[model samples]
Target: MTSFLTISLDFELHWGRFDKTRLRDYLEYYQETLQVVPAILEMFEHYGVHATWATVGSLMADNEEEWRAYMPTVLPQYKYERYSAYRWFDAQPQIWEEALFAPHLVRQLIDCPGQELGSHTFAHFYTCENGGSAKAFRADLKAAKTIAKSKFGQELKSLVFPRNQINEAALAISKEEGFDTVRTNPQDWYWKHTVDENLIKRLFRTGDTLVSLGQKTSYQAPQRNGEELLGLPASRLLRPFRKGSLFNQKRISRIKEEMEAAAKSGEVYHLWWHPHNFGHYPKENLRCLEDILQNFSVLKDTYGMESRSMGEF
Candidate 1:
């Protein structure tokens, strides 16, 4: 098989972070994200990069009533109440439509060339949290598929677990709901477990961005899990561009070297990040992206590296 590059974006504006952040505090950041997504899509088109936007299903709703109409009948009952988006929604008197909902942007992602619209669960469901159940996860997947078909006439075939919390039971439910491909965390020690802030894991994950600390980040191909979903292991995260950071060039160079290795070996290099990562420094981020894509263009010319969406793989 030929070498390939896949990019997936966890495209959940405030919904992804509401549990940890106050919307009012980062209003400007998300506002910039509104502008950044479109520009990012334009660059993807220019670079001929195929990407998947694993979107939060609730963002497809144009209003609160519609959002309510499509919500899963059974919501996740997390022991830690803050992990439940429904509880947060009910507690808030007013919703910031621009920051919380984004049907327009989702539509743009659908119309963009070489883009796949995938699911990030109905409510950014955290499956690994205590009290989460298989029944609730099934309901969440159903709501995700229902809203996508009803609103966009599209079917979701790819999934990315919220916070990279992959559950075996949830994978079975996702396959039954029609998602055939799922993004998995890299097969590295730091990423093998659930999302957490272990000091050592954080330190190593950050260090790996600037230097190799684990196995070769690129892999051969998607593997079939016992649950029957095609597991696409992530290679690296395109870290947000940091202005005047001394290590910025080193980080980009590390990514480029990995891409080259994948290209020469005819392997796959999967890169992912959130659109809001660029919300604060879009210009610098886009420049970093363009630099990376320019490298991909070189590899494409030299080694026939092809760009692919998750579903396409």
Candidate 2:
């Protein structure tokens, strides 16, 4: 059986759209989002699935007082920043919203096993682009880790670069920070020129040959340096995602079939995504998850692949 591994999830909520006005209005839709998070946790608990949440540290700070009421004051610090990947709305609006919502999410993370809280950068900058300057970029990560330690008590280790943007500079800082792994996109040089649907298409890292002339360099797990951070790339999809639902039953069946074949071939198949994706069609996605879980059950029995979070990669 192939020793298979699933990259779990990089769970955060309501990304993709980030306009101030729209963000303010969109906040109304997620009013009940904080409430439904427990159900998502239950799904994983029931399935015996392990996942990693590249936690937004703000999720903890926002709800700090509320959580402290219940948890020890000396909890692990989590990394969440005011202007990080959470760049939406004006600073006040963003801070207010986070203050209202993050505590519950942070508390939810406290006891989850088979999970790792990794750095997703303090500011969700496209370091590869943005001309943000290397010094500025490195400074931002430093601030994020500070927040993570002060707020969550956890040392920032593994990372998932914002949008999987990677380059020599990013590699250097990540290694400096002692991050062991970082997810990277090794598609092509001009692939991300425009942020259209193709933006994701431009993120594929094929055949493990990441450090090609055009592709981002090979990122190893337990990131070492420019070319050493652990690289956990998502496997190929049979087809592009036309719908936003958690993959359907047919896809789950297909994924299971692929895992079976790979186990026979002795290779690692990695699957990953953002958890808030389920929020798009929560009920239907849960159904899809059940299908996927069933297939994983089959895979577990047939192949010896263990579901692993990015920390394990």
Candidate 3:
């Protein structure tokens, strides 16, 4: 059996960080995502890397009107309304920034060979937030499917929950909604899926990026026990490469070590990150990605480790 390496991206533009991020502050970073996407695709093709772009469905629309028209009927009523993308979008009907809409970028991903376009959710739905309901999740899934089919002719088969908030109630709905695979967080206790952020978990997770302070960051193959949906748990998050940071080498080395261990043991290694992670340092991030992929090429020849999209499992 070959060791499998999977890459999934949380490809939400403003929708991913709207609650806390002000577009005015990070406009340049957001704009960089559009510029870096083509370069990222170019690198993937060159390195024979296969990835899943688990995107925000609103990104498929050309404008805010089309996006609003596809809003889920049962919207989430989070205690903090700011968490609701629909509420945020409703407040600002006219989108002044192009950073929020990226139909062209989504189209490029769809047209790219060996790339899978999956759903992050219709509006970056928070499945684990307070007052969230199964009805809302199901409705969100339906809206995502509807827009994706209409825009890109894609039947989305993979899902990466917003904020990695895996809602157990929504698993069956995901299968019924035609999703075959879903990315779960790592098995580590600190990596447990949750809407509420924990300070201890954050400290451990942040420290682990530079050193072996937590889980080994490797997992077995995705489990599909007589079910329509397969559990494609992530092994590690590819921390954004920060230029001029002394910790950059250590972080990259840790990731490489985990990848090597997975390759040698024939385990599964799933690496994920957001496209905006590369927004600030596009060139450096691309170089870091190329280095990782180049190492993967070596692992491929030596151990038959294969690069796969999330749906492949």
On TM-score, the candidate that comes out on top is: 1
> Over the full model, what C-alpha lDDT does candidate 1 score relative to the true structure?
0.91
Candidate 2 positional error at 265, Å: 2.3
Give the winner by TM-score: 1 or 2: 1
TM-score of each: 0.97, 0.72, 0.96
Question: Cα deviation in Å at residue 1, candidate 1?
Answer: 4.0
Give the true-structure RMSD of model 3: 1.4
Residue 191, candidate 1: Cα error in Å is 0.4
Q: Which stretches of candidate 2 lie over 4 Å from their true place?
A: 14-16, 19-21, 63-101, 186-227, 236-249
The lDDT ranking, best first, is: 1, 3, 2
lDDT for each of the candidates? 0.91, 0.54, 0.87
**Candidate 1: segments with Cα more than 4 A from true spot:** 223-227
**lDDT, residue 292, model 1:** 93
Model 2 per-residue lDDT tens digits across residues 1-313: 3465565455455432242234456553465455456676776777777766665433444553532332322221123233233324224444335423464565566566666677665544556554456776676567657766776677877787656566777788888877877655434544343223363344443212222334222222233345566766655322323365454445666556656655656555656666555544556656666666666677677766567666776
- What's model 2's lDDT at 238? 26
Error of 3 at 138 (Å): 0.8
Give lDDT: candidate 2, residue 264. Answer: 59
lDDT of 1 at 53: 97
Residues 1-313, model 1: lDDT tens digits: 6999999999999889989999888889999999999999999999999999999999899988999999999988889999988999899877788898889999998999999999999899998889788999999999999999999999999999999998788887888888899999887899877656598998999999988888888888766666588989999999987777899888889999999999999999999999999987888988999999999999999999999999997
Off by over 4 Å in 3: none
